[model samples]
Target: MSSQAPPIVDDEECRPQISFFQWPDYVVLALMLLVSAAIGIFFGIQARRQKASTDDILVGGRQMATFPMAMSLLASFMSAVTLLGNPAEMYNYGTQFVVIGVGYIMVSPVTAYVFMPVYHRLALTSAYEYLEMRFNKWVRLIGCVIFTLHMITYLPIVVYAPALALNQVTGLDTYAAVSIIFAVCIFYTSVGGIKAVIWTDTFQVLMMFAGMMAVVFKGTVDVGGADFVWQKTVESGRAEFFNMNTDPRERHSFWTMTVGGSFLWIATYAASQAQIQRFLTVPTEKQAVRAIWINCIGLVALLLVCCWGGLVMYANYFDCDPLISGKVKASDQLLPLFVMDTMGSLPGMPGLFTAGIFSGSLSTVSTGLSSLAAITLKDFLIGAFKMELKDSRQASLAKWISLIYGIICFGIVFLVAQIGGVLQAALSVNGMVGGPILGLFSLGILIPWVNWKGAFSGGIVGLVFVGWMGFGAQVEAALGNLSYPKKLLSVAGCNCTTGVLPAPPLPGSYPDIFPLYAVSYMWYAPIGWCITTLIGIAVSWMTKFNDPREMDKRLFSPVLIAIMDKLPLSWQEKVNWPLKPAKKEGCENSGFEFEAENEKVQKSEDENTHKF
Candidate 1:
């Protein structure tokens, strides 16, 4: 009586329903698979017909053009993580994520000017091999290990997230989705090699851009207009264009993301085996530089689309709360939900979006699988087995390795699903592994005084330290004991509970404690580098170890040469130098002579003998 008989609510009014999929969505999903398979098969056949050698398969015969190389790089870098994660980032935290593009932009110029020249000049198959020339075999091995670990952990997450998205749109099982995607990718990559990867990546990149623009255009129209949507976003405090104030504890302050993130970007693009290997596929430094600029422009344009897509999500849910409406359960599903709800009725629209997602995911997975196989074959298998695959058989081994690695990655995708927040997890793992590897490479290049012993020791210590810090933060986050430090706090914005419900409650609640020691993810690279270099220099002084005098000059940056020249006479001059130069002029050159001589003298009497 007091409640007026519970308002006589009807069941239909009490429980609202949302359409998950339509016929058009299924049609789009089918088209996505068909197109991806067609591209893969076409390239796979082309690669087999070419009978591409190992070098050709791994590095595109070192003859890639500027446009294709640039497009491949862009496609590889802008995976589903960028396509979906960046927008989700803006929707959740604000526009601070755009600073990532700034860091990426800065990295491109530095890569073109500083890193590309050295990498191109070396013509290395694996970037880590340069470490051997700069320092020692151990340094090279360590670098390869780090790259292997980083790729294994990082690439799986990239593969899995997009599969999850596709699952939402296509109603396919996540594992089935992952298997279909990777099988197509692996088949093409195993057969076609890098040339196949490059050409396919170019097509995927175009699809990515087209799909993203379509989403933007459709979203803008759905939101009433671009101006109205942007205004609503601005008023909601999601369209923050700039935030210059520095706060180390913040996830992304302007200075933190700009300066610190730049170093991380440098590590990934300039020093990483994945990106460096791509650059080396081209024949010359100039073309590599051109590719870098092309990628830079593409990156900026792609990020703008991603950020705008986030605003579209906000605009679509401007009045209604999808979370309350039961449209979706998690924030990750927001964009997919929006696409299905807004454009599901249109012919080919849902398929276009699905195709775009597959393009992003498969492009990334294929590059990763191919690169991982190449690195493993060149860096680990050959190093350990002492067996040489002849030119005739190298492509066969590469193809087999690509197949194996792709399968491994496909399995790892299931594991990645157990982890949360694809972008953050990917970056965190990358920082932990990539930072120390970058530090080691930087030490080898920029600090020549860091001898093999010192470099090895410093790398180990840096890896341990960064691992502890990153893991500790992750644990604290899991325990619900982490918070933004007071100094990092921004003004409170609209607490919109749209599209997703609040995260499920934990087993036990704990007091909120701000993480004062937390630093921006971007800072990890520079910090790790600083730690490794400083430790290396100190350890070198203690141990009195110096690089061999005959090491290649290309391995040392200008700064390192200056440091070496300033060092006073010490044991370095004695142990690292020959007592007398050979009678032949340029006999001591660190080129074919050094390699040939070392190989000849070091090889066992056995005809099959080989050494790394």
Candidate 2:
């Protein structure tokens, strides 16, 4: 499973000021931020007349139109990471990575049929609230904590990816780019709330499509045409896919991208708060589900364009191999370099493209900040305060939390880097944090026997294992240790002064690293989920388990229930058991009931059961 370090090639394209940026570009970026601010102000003003409730700021008062939610959902998913890193992924690894979208497509139906129904029926303000109902407040807290870790690790990378791109594009320091993104993103998001986020996301989505299209089409034409690009790609072996390799350590085989990626999509969408929050902004469950479908379609289309843009980049630089010559400092720099190389002649084109990148980054960061803020207020703070606050107070709290979180996120940007590649780095971190979360939730919704105890234990163990594996791999990559097998390029056709690509440098040759750590980043979520679910189920069975039938039907999975119903009567009776009802007030709580609050416990558990 061990891989050799890539041979380092001499540099020719690594020059300072590869191109100069125009004034129109600045204006384009400026106008995009200004428009973002205006959208926030307008939404803020409208919300005030309605007394600006917490729901208004957090979920757009559940008055958001369909198209906007769809756009925002996809834009948020398109993070600066995706905008810049996706192209880099294709440019380096080839098009096999694009098949990851199959995993994405697989998650949509589950979101519509399983996860959304419970949240919608319960009117959940926070996704973790469902955890509290299914297990206990303690379990909800575990979910909240895991989600916070996920967002904290993720949001910083979101800011850093485009900042790295900006550094390459405009000679802007990463600090300056990070600061500028933070300011605009914080201002608009804090003022406007979710509604502002939605509308701005819509505009940004268009800019994203426009910018990507311009680069792709223009670059394709410059390289010859669509046919020319395809011929070059296939000839270069860059168009290859269907890697039937069964090696668990193989990075992007079909199973890894589609099967492994399917869980990442679940972690990213079905189990994610940013997406679910956007979904709930619409008025009806149907509209929310519609948004989910729209999001899937848009995601595939945008990602495919970005992937093709990568191919076009390859066609244009087929022989040059920018990475070998050091023209590109990082893989992430390839796309920006290509844009400047091809479209730099048009005055506003660079601006439009850069703004387009910022658009994707801003939308994602704002969405995360807003969602994290809501989770903080609803899941963490409000409950911790042990009392209800006024609607106005709650709304104010959400805004302040969002503002503060945005600032905190910026501080983490210093931690971002080209560890391997930004795309893989971000996803590995996401899997580390998100896998256990999806597992915890999956346990809550499917295995009625799972209790807070098993959830807590499983979550901690799963997080530790996945987190360890993810960071170990990243550290190795950062240290030039772990290497993934990839197609090599030749300098024979590169118009260069340098001699034949210096034989790729040989390594000191160390022993193989752990296979667990070598599993592709694509498998992180699935592994994490499996660990947590399996361990959680075992631990729950060892303790006092609840019968799903005795609990709120909404808290469990509709799919699980349907399957259970179809089982033979004898098997169903053998597999299911009733949860023991609460004892007469003198006993210690096993987290099934809480703090002698009989009325509240009854309302949360028994009431829902009665309704079902």
- For each candidate, the alpha-carbon lDDT, in order, equals 0.70, 0.78
Positional deviation of 202 in candidate 1, in angstroms? 0.5
Q: Write the per-residue lDDT of candidate 1 for residues 316-347, one digit (tens) a residue.
A: 76555443444455556677777877787887
Model 2's TM-score against the true structure:
0.90
> Candidate 2 residues 1-612, lDDT tens each?
223333454444334345667899888878888998899888878877778899899988766778888899889868777888888878767889899889779888988887876566555678877777676678778778888877877888878877777787788887899899899889888888899999999999999998899999899889999998888778766686798777777777888998788888888777788887876676566777777898899999998999999889888877667766557767888899999999988988988888888888899899999999899998887764465888899998888888999888888777754443768777777777778889988887778778778888888889899889887887776666677544545545554434333332232322278777677888889889999998898888898776555564555566777787788888878867333343433212233322223333223332222210
**Whole-structure CA lDDT of model 1:** 0.70
| Model 2 residue 218 CA deviation in Å | 0.4
Per-candidate RMSD, Å: 8.0, 5.3
Determine which window of 10 residues in candidate 2 has minimal summed lDDT. 603-612
Runs off by more than 4 Å, candidate 2: 1-14, 417-420, 493-511, 577-612
Q: After superposition, which runs of candidate 1 have C-alpha atoms over 4 Å from their true positions?
A: 1-32, 483-517, 545-549, 558-612
